[model samples]
Target: MQLSWSQPCSSGMIQLLLVSNLLLWECVVSRPMCLDIGYKKLFLQELFDRATVIAQYTSNLTMQMSEEFDENFAKNLEYKARNSSTCHTASLTTLEINEQIQQTQSDELLKVMISISRVWYHPLEHLVCEVAARKGTCETMLSKIKELEEKNQELLEEMKGILVRVHPGAEENAYPAWMGLAEVRSDNEDTHHFALSNLLHCLRSDTDKIVTYLEVLKCQVIHNNNC
Candidate 1:
C-alpha cells in the first residue's frame, strides 16, 4: 500500500508557520521605496525655496513702505514748521492723523509677512520628518498639501484686505506693480494682492503635481505587489 502525505498535526508547528508569515509581512511593509523618497525630498526643497523667495520679497516691501512713510512724514513736518505762524494746531493734528494711518498700514504689512512665514514653516517641518522617517502614507501627504493650500488661500485674502485698506478705489495706474491690465478696470486692486494671488496659484499647482505623483507611485507599488 502507498503512504499518503498528511497535514501538520502539532500546534507548535502551526504556530511557527504563523509567526514566519507575520515576519514576512512586516519585512514587505517596512521596506522603503527609495525612488519615491528621493522625489519627495526634491519636491519639498523646491517648495521651501519658493517660500523663502516670497518671504524675502515681502520683507523688502515692508521696509520700503516704512521708509516711504517716514520720508513723507518728515517732509510734511518740515513744511508745517516753516508755516507754523499760520495754523500751528491744525497742522499738528493733521500730522498726527497721517502718522496714525502710516502706523496702521505698516502693521498690516508686517502681519501679512508673519502669516506667510507660519504657512511655510509648519507644513515643511512636518513633511521633512515624515519623509525622513518614511512613516507617513501618500494619503497623509495629500491631506497636508490640501491643508497648506487652504492656509495659503487665506493668506491671499489677508493680503487683499491689506491692499484694499492701503489703496481704496486705487486706480490701476496707482499701483501698477500689483494690478493687472484686466484687474486695472477694477478700482480695488493693488500690487500686494496681485503678488499674493500669483503665489497662491503657484503653490496650488505644485501641490497638485505632488498629489498626482503620489497617486501614481502608490498605484504602481500596489500593482507590483499584486504581480
Candidate 2:
C-alpha cells in the first residue's frame, strides 16, 4: 500500500508569484524623481514664518480685549444677580407675613405693600433690558471678527506672492541687506530673487521664532472658543 499527501499550493505557483513580485518591485524602483526642494521650499518657509508672526500678534490683541470685556461683564452680572435674588426673597416674606397680621392701619399698610411689590419686580425688568442689549452687541462683535479673518487671509496670500517672486534660485548673485529693501521699494525684478531668499532665511532663523509662537496662540484661541 502507498500513501500520498496534499499541499496548499504547488511549488510552481509559488515560483510564479515570486517572479511577478520581483518585476513589480523593479518597476517601482526605476521611477522618476518626485520633489526638488531647490528654492521653492525656502520661499514657502519664509512666507509661513512671517504670516505666523502677524497671526500671533493679532491673536494676542484680540485675547486681551476679550479678557477685559469678560471680566467686566462677569462683575456686572454677579452684582445684579445677587441684588435681584435678595429683593425677590424680601418681597415674598413681607407679603406672606402681612397676610397674617391681626391688626394694622388699613390705608398705610396697603400703600407699603404696593411699594414693596414694585421694588421686588423692578430688578427683573432691568435684567431683561440688559440681556437684550448684550445679545445685540455680541452679534455685532461676531460679524466684525469674521471680517477681520477674511482680511487676514487676503494679506497672507499677498505675502506668499512676494515670496515666490524673490526666490534665490531665480538670481545668481546675492545682494547686501540694504540693496534687498531698495530693490523691493523700486519694484525691480532683478533684485527680487535676492530679497526673497533673504526674507525666507530671516523668517526661519532661531532669533525669529514668531511663527512657532503664533501657531500656538491660534490653537489656544480656537480651543478657548470651543470650550
Taking all chains together, each candidate's TM-score versus the true structure is 0.26, 0.24
Worst lDDT run of 10 residues, candidate 2, spans 171-180
- How many residue pairs clash in each candidate at the backbone level? 1, 0
The digit string of per-residue lDDT tens for model 2 on 23-56 reads: 9987776552223343544555565456665545
lDDT of 1: 0.37
- Model 1: per-residue Cα lDDT over 41-135, one tens digit each: 55544443444444334434333433332242323443333322221111121112323433333333333333333344443333334323332
Best by TM-score: 1
Candidate 2 stretches with Cα past 4 Å from truth are 1-36, 76-227
